[model samples]
Target chain A: MTRAAPNPARRIREDIEGRIHSGEWKPGTRIPIEQELAARYGCARATVSKALAELVAAGLVERRRKAGSFVAHPPVHSAVMTVPDLAELIAARGESYRWEARAILRRKNAGGADTLQIDGIHFAADEPFALENRTIELAEVPAAAEANFAAEAPGTWLLAHIPWTSARHVVRAVAATRAEAAALATGSGAACLQLERDTWRGDRPVTHVRQLFRGDRFDLVAEFQAGTGKREGN
Target chain B: MTRAAPNPARRIREDIEGRIHSGEWKPGTRIPIEQELAARYGCARATVSKALAELVAAGLVERRRKAGSFVAHPPVHSAVMTVPDLAELIAARGESYRWEARAILRRKNAGGADTLQIDGIHFAADEPFALENRTIELAEVPAAAEANFAAEAPGTWLLAHIPWTSARHVVRAVAATRAEAAALATGSGAACLQLERDTWRGDRPVTHVRQLFRGDRFDLVAEFQAGTGKREGN
Candidate 1:
C-alpha cells in the first residue's frame, strides 16, 4: 500500500503541537495570526484556521475573539485507573530512571502461605519521585517468591508477568510523614499524593501496592463527555 | 411492569452494605464466619459465602484463606472528572452544607466582553471544606450575569442552567498557601487537593474553576477492566 501525502491542516497542527510540547511556545504566548501563519506555511488561511481549531479542541490552544490564539497551560494528565510503569514514564520524559529496593521481606500469612513485601523508591533524574510499598501473594505467583527485585521494580515485573483482569485505584492527598519525607528528600509535612491500587486475576487478588508521590512532581487528569461518563480519546 | 422480588443474595449484599455505610462495622473488624452468618440469617452456608464474596469484590470486605473476612477500610471516592455539586455531596454525608460567596466581580475580557468572577467558600458541618475560584464567560451564558450567587453556588446554578458538552480536569496535590489556608481554616503548608476544571459548550468555553479541597476530607476512586480503557459501572 502506498502512503498518501499528509494533510496540510494536520501537518500544521502537529507542527504547532511540537512547539508547545518542546517548550518553545510557553503557555499564554500568543501565536501568529491566521494570515501570518498561512503566509509562513504557504497554505490557505482556512487551513491554518482548521489547525488552530483542532488544537483548541485538543486543549493545546485557546482562542479569543479579538485577540490572537495563545498556547494553553499544559497540565500533565495521566489515566487515573491505569497502572503506569514508572520507569517507562520517566524515560518517556527524557529523564534518567533508577529503582532502589529499600527493603524486601518474605513472611508466612495467617493461612500459612508465603507472601512477599517490597519497599522501594523510584528516582527520576536522580531525584526521588515516588516511594512505593508493594505486597505479592506468593501462592498466586510463586515465581515472585524467588524473583530478584533489586534490579527491577516489582510493579514493572508484575505488569510483565501477570495478566490482570481488573484493577481498583484510590487516590488521595496527604501530608508527608517524617519517614516519607526522609525517603523522598522532602521536608516533613510536605504535600504528597497517595495512590493505593489493587489488581486481580479473575477472582484471585494478584497484588496490593501503595505509592506516595511528591505532590509537586505528579498529578492526574481525565477528560469526559457530557452524558457518557467516558474519558476522551479512550 | 411490576418489580420482581429481590434476589436473596442481593438482599444479603445490601444488608451488609448498609451496615458498612452506617459505620456500624468499622474497618478491620472480623465478620462472622459463613456458618455463623448462615445460622443467624437462616440461610444456607453457600448463600452467606456468596454474599461475602460479593462484598470482597466490591472492596467492602477482605477474606483470608484460614482467617474469617473482615471489613475493609472505607475511602470516600468521587469521580475525578465529574462536576459534583458540593452542597449535595456534603448533604449526602449528613453534614450541614453552606455556600458563602466571598467576592464577586464583573470585568471585561481582552475582547471587550463581559466576564464574571466569583470567589466562594464551601462549609460542611460548619467547617470550611473547599476554597473555590470560578470564572464564567458572560458571552456564553448571559444568564449568569444576573444569577443570585449569594443564595446558590455558581456550580449548582450552572449545572441547572447550562448543558456542558465536554470538560477537562487537572488534579494535583499542593501545600496550601497562606491565603488558601486562611480561607480553608487550615494551617499554612497543609496538604490540599487542587482540582482545575474547564468546561465547554460545543466549541465555546463556558467556565473555568479551581477548587482546593482539604486533604483529610476527600479522595477519588475508580475501577477499571483490564483492556477496555473504560471505567467500571460507567
Candidate 2:
C-alpha cells in the first residue's frame, strides 16, 4: 500500500546518467572505479557494477578491462527519426538561438478546415542554421490558428502544446536553390541537408514540415549494436 | 521435446508480412476484409483480426475505420543505423549493379598489422550511384587481405564474411570537389550526400568507410511512434 524504497543501483545509474546528459562528464572522462563508486555511494561494489553495466548497455559508458570505465562519446545520431526542437538543439551547443518568421498564411482546406503555413529561419550564434516551412492543420489544432508564431518557432510551440502519435522523416541532400541559398546564407548550388517530416495524432495529420540546413554546419549521426533491434530515441 | 504447432494467427501474420516484405503487396494495396481473410485462411474472424492487429503494431499494415486494412507504404526509413549491403540494395531496385575498384592500397599500422584501403565506384544500371572509400583493419579481418575486391565490393564482401559488433554512421551533405565530381560524373560543387561509417568487432575496429551519393538520387527515411523508443533494424 505504500511506496517502495528506491533501488540503490538505479539511483547510482541515474546519478551518472544525469552527469553525462548534463555534459558535466564529457566524453572520455573516466568514471570512478567500482570500488570507488561503492565507497562513495555507500553501496556494495556489485551495485556499482550493475549501474555501470546498465550505462554500458545504454551506450553511455565504455568499460576497459584493466582501465576504469569512461563516458562514451556523445552520439551525434538521432533516434532513426525524431521530432527535435531546433531551439533546444542550438542552445545545447552553447549558442544563442533565434527564430525569425518570414511569412505566414492562413487558408481553408478542401474539408473547410483552416490550415496555417509558416516560413521561417532559425539561427544559432547569429548564423543561419536552417530554413523551415511548416503547415499546421488548424482543424486538429485550433489553438494554432491564433498562436503568435512570429514571436516563437511553431515547431517548439507545437511540441509543448500537442501530443503527437506518429512521425515520419525523409532526409536527403540537394543543391541549394537561389532563394534557399539567400535565406540560409550559403552559396547557391551548395550541398544542403533537407529533412521533411509529417506528424500525426492518431488517424489525423497534425503538421508537415520541411527544413533545410547548411551542408557545412549540420549532419545526422546514428549508432547501432550488432544483432539488436532496439534503438533509443533522441 | 516436441515442437508446438504454430498458432493460426501467427501463421496469417507471417504470410502477410512475407508478402509485404517481398513487395508482392505494394503500398496502399487494400487487404481483404476480416470475413474474407477468415474464409480464405479457414480461420475464425477473430483470428484474422488478431493477425491484422499484430501487423498494425509492426507498422506493416494500416487499418481504417470504415475501410479495410491496407499494406502500408514501404518505409524509406532505415533502422537508425545499419550496415547495408550495397549490392543487395541496388539489386532490390531492379538495377544492374556493378562494383569497380578504382584503387587498392595495403599498409602497415603502428601495431604492424595490415590495413587495406579501397577506393571504388558503385554503379546502378550503368550510372555511378556512389563513390566509396573504405579501410579494413586486417588484424580484425584477416580474410580481407586476400579478398579479391576488384571483382566484388568490400562492403558487400565484409557483410558476407565478417560479423560486426557495432557500427556508427554520420550523414551529411557536402559540395563535391573537382575529383569527386569527376568520379561521380557530376559538376563541381554539386550537392552530395556523404555517409561515413565505422564498424567494429567487439572493441576492435573492423572497417571504416565513407560513401558519397548523388544528392538527387539517394536519401534516408525514418519513422517513429510517440512514447516509444524501440526502432527496427533495416
Candidate 3:
C-alpha cells in the first residue's frame, strides 16, 4: 500500500518539537492555537490537532480542559542515577578516592547472565572498609574491554567506552558474606547495600552489573516529581 | 482563542488507546494502515496520524520508517514496585507476615524534611534486627494520624487513608547511628539499607518516610525497558 510521502501531521509535529527542543518555545510558553496553526501550515484543523496530540503524549505539551495547551512545564518524572564512577563519587564528598582492583575474570554474559566479578577496595582506617563486588557478562564486554579492565576498573572503563541508551537499577540490602566481611575488614554477615544495573543500547542489552557497597560508607539520594505516570525503569 | 468543539482526533486517539489497553489490540498486531484508519474514523489522514503518534509516545505502538505502525510488543519499561506493605511482602514470599510497632512519634514533615520516626521491630531469631525510622512533616500528617498510629503502623495507616497519586524513592547505604543500634538491637556501626520515600496527592505533598532494613533480609528488584527519551527528572 502506498503511504503519504510527507505525512503533514508528522511534519507539523516535528516542527513544533524542534522549536521546543531547541528552546525556541520555552517551557510554559503557549504556542499558537490550532486554528492559527492550521492556517499557518495550510492544513485542516484536524491536522493541527493531531500534531498537538503527539506533543501532549510526549509530555512536551500540556492541555487543560478549557485553557487550550501550553508547552508542558518540563515534567518532574525523571530519575537521576549518575553514571557509576567510584573515584568521582568519593571525590565529590571531599574524601580521598582510593581504589584497588582485586580480581578481573573473563566470562560469558549471555541472556543477562553475568560472568565477571571485579572487587573495588577502599581504605578505612580502624573502620570496616566497604566491599564493592561487580559482576559483568562476557558478551557485553567491548573489544577493548580487557585492556581497559587491566588499566583501570571495569566500571570506569565501561563508562568511557560504552554508550548505553537505557538502564535499570535495583537497590537492595543484604548481609555481607564471610568472604565479603574479610575483604571489607568487617565481621562475617555485616549489613551491605547491593545495586544491580542493566544497561542496553536500543533492543540490545550491553551489560548487567551488580555492585555491593559497604553500608556505613555510602548513600544514594534521588528526588523526583510525582504523577506523570512515567514508569521508573528507564 | 476559539477552539474546535468535539475534537475528532482526540476521540480517535482514545478509541485506539482503549482497544490497546483492553487487550482488544494485542501486542505485535498491526491494525489497519493510516489510510484505512482515517477512512474508518471519518477524519483526515492527519487526524489518524496524530492519534497513532500518541500511542507511539506512550510505548503502546511502534511506527516503522515506512512500514506503518503496529501495537508495540509488550514494553519492558514498566517499573514494578509494589505498594510498601511489610505483611503483604512476607506473605507473598510464602512466609508468614509479622510486624510489631515499636515507636510512633508525632513530628513535622516540612518540605520533605522529616521529623517523625516509626520503628518496626523484627522478630528475628538471632540475627541483627533492623530499625525503621520514619520522619514526617506535621503538615502532611492527617487529622486522624495520631489515632491511626496508636492503632497500627503509620506506613500502613497512610497507605490505607491517604490516596497518594505519586511517590519518589531514594535508596542508600549508611552506617547505623548509636541510638539506632540500640533501638534496632544491632551494633552502632553496623550497615543498613536506608529507603526514603515521599508520596504526594497531586500538587500537595502527603508524606515522607524513611525505612532502615536489615541488610541481610531485604532486597528490592526493579526491571525496565530502554530508549524512551524521558529524562530522569521528568
For residues A40-133, write the lDDT of model 2, one tens digit per residue.
8888887798778767756678899989899875332333432357776677679987778878888988998989999889999888999999
Compared with the true structure, the alpha-carbon lDDT of candidate 1 equals 0.74
lDDT of 1 by residue, A191-217 (tens): 999988877765677789999999998
Ranking by DockQ: 2, 1, 3
Q: Number of backbone collisions per candidate, in order?
A: 0, 2, 22
Docking tier of model 1: it is: incorrect
Cα lDDT for residue B111, candidate 3: 52
Evaluate all candidate structures by whole-model CA lDDT and list the values in order.
Answer: 0.74, 0.76, 0.60
Top-TM-score candidate index: 2
DockQ of candidate 1?
0.21
| lDDT of each residue in B137-178, candidate 1, tens digit only | 999889999999878888778766663346777778999999
DockQ of 3: 0.18
- Candidate 3 is graded, for docking, as incorrect
Provide per-model DockQ scores. 0.21, 0.24, 0.18
Tell me what TM-score chain B of candidate 2 gets against the true chain B. 0.64
Highest lDDT among the candidates is held by which one? Answer: 2
In Å, residue A1's CA in model 2 sits off its true spot by 26
**Chain B alone, TM-score of each model?**
0.62, 0.64, 0.55
Compare candidates 2 and 3 on TM-score and give the better one.
Answer: 2
Q: Please report how far candidate 2 places residue B79 from its true position, in Å.
A: 7.7
Local accuracy of candidate 3 as per-residue lDDT tens digits, B1-234: 223337977788777766764557767778789999877877778778877776676566889977878877644333333334543344455654335666766554445544566666543443434455555555655454455554455555554544333566677776667887676676676666777777665555666667776555566654444223343310
